[model samples]
Target: MTEFIPRPDQPASTSRMPSPLVTMIVAGAVLSLCMGLRQSLGLFLQPMRAELGVSASAFGFALALQNLTWGLAQPVIGMFGDRYGPRPVLVVCGFLYSAGLLLMALGGPTIGLNIGAGVLSGVGIAGCGFGLVLGAVSRSVPPEKRVQAVGAVSAVGSLATLVIAPVCQAIIENDGWQAAALSFAAVAATIGVIALFIGGKPAPAKDHSAVASNTRQAVGEAIRHPGFVAMTLAFFACGFQLQFITVHLPTYLGICGVSTEIGAIALGVIGIANAVGSYVTGRLGTRYRPKQLLALIYLLRTVAITAFVWFPVSAFSTLAFAAIMGLLWLGVVPLVSGTVARIFGLQHFNTLFGIVFLSHQIGGFAGAWLGGVSYDLTGSYMTAWVSMALVGLGAFVLQWSMDDRDRPAPGIKDSLLGTS
Candidate 1:
């Protein structure tokens, strides 16, 4: 028998690891279900507020709470996933997601909305969303193939928005908002079931004491890394911009005299285009540096927002804006996740990315809440839109200035599938 050791640059592989194809397929399905249902919640906003007699600010606050909860809960859930495995965590979150949606449907405006939409759904999203899912995917594939794997999952998952948004809109139109909420609950219940097939769990560190010490060191190293700090800060802008648009765009379109159908159509267009963008961006990651690509995304997003708002709103302009925005959308995920893996290796990837994502969710909370406050106070979302663009421009500078060079901790190896 020969002693085997994997180099720090190469991940250890073994027979017990799940097949890459199976891992990808299962991961993609989970993403599609979880993200699709989550994103479509915006469709319930108008009807729920009208019926519940809730102020726009109140409704926005609930959604804002959801983002905040998701962020606050992510690192803890991610730790669970990293330690116990994604399957059980995802299973529990799926049911939580379903229950939250049900509560939102049944619980009156404030209680249901806050507890269901804000708290439970937020925690559910923390478990099933990009940070944990992508971390799982990354560990299942080779470093050279990691970008493509992540991109593919993101692209496939993005397609869910195309169908989910429209379906929810139709349900809201025909069956009422409560029915739409219930439908979302039903869909969410499937996430856990699908998660059963996802593979790749964290390898146990050789010694429990060593693992504890390494984790502390790893967290400190990431915090001290200028690139990680820059990336985390820049991610806030990403959340602020995207969430503001997702939550407010429908209302903005309605204000501009576009039909609700047109708004739904715009969202669908975004979904379709996002698939392409996610895939192309992943391929581009192979050639261009992740930091550069991220900077470009922010710059382009700022331009699109500036142009979309500056010009008068029309169905044509709205859909066109959606196309542009969609193309630039989830493209950020692969780059961000890949950067974490490259810089820190896989040991604490989910937790590290969760920390970065907390910044994003904080921005989400601000963006969603402030959009309502701005509109309520100013009679226009123009102020929020302007703020979003400025923040994005600032993120561009931060991302561009980041140094994303690989600097894994001394004891951390590229523990992909088998190595402990």
Candidate 2:
């Protein structure tokens, strides 16, 4: 049998991969559950804070821990997904996610919130979120189509936000935050079903049996690569920009005298807009350099944030800002993952991407937590908002500095998945 030279991590039994559309759908559905649940949690901020009798800073810190832990766990979870495939990781993490929500509903002390919302849910997100899904979808597609596939998968999350945010608001209004959290938990627990349908596998190294060695080598090389390092720094800015808005936009709008209902609607508008933006960005990613696109996206975000803060806060402004921000939202995710795949190949793509995503989570921690802290101390979010724009400028510079050209290293080699 002629050897298959250009395999992008298909299952071992077949030289060719499974259907890209099927893999994308499965990954997208799972992401819908994971991302949608997180999106709705912003609505819980005021309610939970009021009930818990905590300052915004304290509550925000707990959520910051969620970002922190998620970033910390990403590489480990990616390792598991790379070693054993995403199914087991997804199944286990989905249950962990449910348990975390249930614990949060129990409503004991601050420690419980940290344990539930911070640690457990963070780990859960690491396993079930972008790195795992994007890696799977990337491996299932042709090299030419990788960014588009990843973007389509990301758009599902945005679509979920559009659909689930309203539904979550309705549930919270009718049932209570506890019930809402439990309901979201149930949605996450169902991700196992989608995991079963997801296609593709870890890329086989020259020595197929040496999975562990291959993983370590891939990780080591990626960490040392200048392009990967620059990409990670750029990603940190993306996380910081996104989390501040996603987690606190509802609360911020409410402070601006916007009704909670309107705030929720604005978030949904962001979702619908993001759905379009992510897809369009993905298509553009194929036509343009991912790094350059990312830099441009950051520039756009800086401008959007500037306009949003400068304008008078109102129903129209809130929705318009969200719609504009939504288009930029998650557009970077697929591009980041695609750039990783394009430069490195499918071998250990999950783990490599996870490591890069860790930087984003750290920024998430700073963005979400600091926004609250700044608001509590200064009585406005101005400090954090201004800071976010500054960081966006920094991110654009770092992305511009990245060298996407492939260079051989100890562990990073020519891609087996190269398009002939």
Best by TM-score: 1
> Which candidate's lDDT is highest?
1
Please give the lDDT score for candidate 2. 0.80
The lDDT, on a scale of 0 to 1, for candidate 1 is 0.84
- Report the lDDT tens digits of candidate 2 across residue range 1-420: 111122233322213335767778888888888887777778888877777776777767878899999999998998887777777788788888878877777755476578888898899888889988887777666677888888888988778888788888888889888888888778878886667777545445322223324677777777777999999998998889888887888889988999999878987898889889999988888777788888989999999999999989999988889889999998999889887876667667778888898999999999989999998999999999999999999999999878876655632233333322
Clashing pairs in 2: none
For all predicted structures, in order, the TM-scores are: 0.93, 0.91
Instruction: List, residue by residue over 1-420, the lDDT tens digit for candidate 1.
Output: 122122234342424447778877888888888888877777777897688887667888888999999999998898887677777888899899899999999999988999998899999999999877887787777777777789988999889889999988999999999999988999999998888877546554322112334556767878878899999999999889888888888988989999888888888888889889999988887667888889999999999999999999999999999999999999999989888777666767778889999999999999999998998898899999999999999999999999776554444443322256
Among all windows of 10 consecutive residues in model 2, the one with the lowest summed lDDT is 1-10
Local accuracy by lDDT, each model = 0.84, 0.80
Clashing pairs in 1: none
